[model samples]
Target: MQQRRDKDWDLSIGPDTVRLFILKAKAISAGVNEDYEDGAEHEVEFDGDARDNHHHDGLAEEETEDLTARELRELIGDLNVDEAAELVALAWVGRGDYDASEWQDAVAEARQRGNRRTAKYLLGMPMLGDWLEEGLEVLGA
Candidate 1:
């Protein structure tokens, strides 16, 4: 991804930070819908009757998802009011609720909505990562 030039846009939060959030969001998305045994080969044994044995190794995956989610939540929670609102506005643009030309209006609306539940609201979106990435692209970040 190309770095956003300071002269080109005035962003409350850094693009790099947004990229990190995208990565974590994608990880959480994958972890939530993933099946542990999708492509693994299992050995079957015949002792009187055929038996299929495969261990469901979802515990580790669950833990990783939990950690990633926590990190994402923390990251969003730590942002300042302006930064958090910017994130919401970016998402709105990415989701097609607003066009890139309406960025200021979207940001104003996001700020009006407040950042009290920003993390929770953002985390609830299953397509958070994709939307954020699309938003960044739209903004030429």
Candidate 2:
């Protein structure tokens, strides 16, 4: 199979926002090199139970404020891999400030063009999930 682009490994994001599922597969799955290891798979995360958790460390702040409750929900309604990845990328674009109108417009346009996927596919390699799953809250479906 072809390897994901360098952007997928380390996006130097600028005016354009692009992400491919192939990269997610690479980052979430096995790594390159002879001593490659499935770190995420075997890494023991013993933070604590949800009740006692005060982990704000993993979450990024909002970026696109324009993504209103309805808009964001609509975007994530039937998300696919691409959409999920884009959401993750967008979160970065928003710089953890996910409350911008431009971001909302971009997402909406991408959706119109048939982008958006389940968040499961865009977990690591930059696109944070704690950030993505929260969008589901907007949908409340």
Candidate 3:
């Protein structure tokens, strides 16, 4: 019998980002898990996004669009909790779409999911990180 993969994992993202990430994770999980208990737990201001309307009704739809990896990184700038979590989910399937840029956010996000250590190390190229870092700034991520 195969062992079932556990979904929740522990991770770090600089102390400054940890709390923000936790809130984002909560909001995304709440949105994705329809049966999620305590509906009030995930509520936030939900306004101030340009993609959304004055009432914030369009925020959900705006997040549904796929962005390039480079776009994704720059997009994460000052993202609220829900947006950040959603972006991390997108990164898992974001290969080929990502420019060399987006290294830091990619690595930080991958670490957040606890999957990067094994997966990233196994890629066999030591310079992937360097390329990602340099390219992220160059690509304007």
Candidate 4:
């Protein structure tokens, strides 16, 4: 892959937008994991075991689609196709799936993957915030 030589990485999306996304991702991550703070138990029901005791992994439905999730979704929903693709690429970079050296490749891959469910896809990642931040740092943005 050809190296991106300049300090100005040609991201279709702005760094401020990426930073905002980072903030929301961080909030969502924190909110989802918040319930487990004091050993708060969440109940999970299993099939064919109505009588059996339920175990909680703190991934309750409410937690999954909480205010943070909604806000994150809204934020993602507002992004255009190009921006969404860039966001995905950044997340992948942060996750160690791709290095900054392969930034263009990562972005191309993200573009090919489609951006229809970016919010859901990103929200599903447990470390979305950290990954995006890492990607930003790698890009020197």
Candidate 5:
């Protein structure tokens, strides 16, 4: 087993919670490119064209993705203002917007830009999971 890194700084949000967000974010990212129907089954009348009869796979996976997204949204929504801001700062750091040594400035900026739509903003990011993981690693958390 690999040795765990030591955490030398204080974080408003716990590492385990960040890991959970990373997991859910990765699931959402993976599902984004998959072909899933809009929860509808259609009977196509083909006019000698095979393209018209094309159907998407993974309805079950779509449902799971929906649930995971909802869970992630709720998790982010449930965090207090400080925790949410810290999370955003962590992402910014991970994305190379700021260095780990400038954590306090990042967190302050995040708090200044804090809003009720933190979850929505974060979920819209394509590499949220990877960024968050990188942030944690950089912080040695």
Candidate 6:
């Protein structure tokens, strides 16, 4: 992998940070689907008192929102403009929107289109973490 060009662009965010972000994104995406055996492995019977006390769903929507999603929001919110743009560019590159040879172009576009809802935009991507990881690999960071 080739190192990112220092003369053309100065990426303030490090690879480690991107890696961590990708990890969190992956976690959140994976958590979207909870797969568990329905009495396939083990079975337990509950009495009336037990059933009455524990009659809640697996996880509420609000509870799911608080996990990796909130963490990702905070992470994106804390990033500066340049860092945020770089992240967007990385995602773009990873998603094949821009090739590694067009890294500068991707970064430039990211900066131009950056907004307050970067976290939301990023979260909307189905393979965000994979894309980001690919971008980092392309950048050789």
Deviating ranges (above 4 Å) for candidate 5? 1-8, 34-58
Best by TM-score: 1
Q: Which scores better on TM-score, 3 or 4? A: 4
| Candidate 6 positional error at 115, Å | 2.7
- Give the Cα lDDT of each candidate: 0.84, 0.36, 0.36, 0.79, 0.85, 0.79
Give the C-alpha miss distance for residue 73 in model 1, angstroms. 0.2
Q: What's the residue-level lDDT of 136 in candidate 3?
A: 24
lDDT of 5: 0.85
For model 4, what is the C-alpha lDDT against the true structure? 0.79
Which residue ranges in model 3 land beyond 4 Å of their true spot?
1-13, 35-141
Q: Write the per-residue lDDT of candidate 1 for residues 1-141, one digit (tens) a residue.
A: 323323445899999999999999999888765643465333445566565454556577678789999999999999999999999988887888887778889899999989999999999998999989988888888
How many Å off is the CA of 4 in candidate 3?
A: 28
Q: In candidate 1, where is summed lDDT lowest over 10 consecutive residues?
A: 1-10
- For candidate 2, write residues 16-126 as lDDT tens digits: 222222223333333221123544532345555635334442223222222232333443455564444456545443344443324545455544554434332333234
RMSD of 6: 5.0
- Per-residue lDDT tens digits for candidate 5, residues 45-131, read 566665666554557767888999999999999999999999998898888888877888999998998759999999988899999
Segments in model 2 whose C-alpha atoms lie over 4 Å from true places? 1-98, 116-121, 124-127, 133-141
- The TM-score between candidate 6 and the true structure equals 0.75
Please rank every candidate by TM-score, starting with the best: 1, 5, 6, 4, 2, 3
lDDT of 1 at 62: 74
User: Lowest summed-lDDT stretch of 10 residues in model 2?
Assistant: 1-10
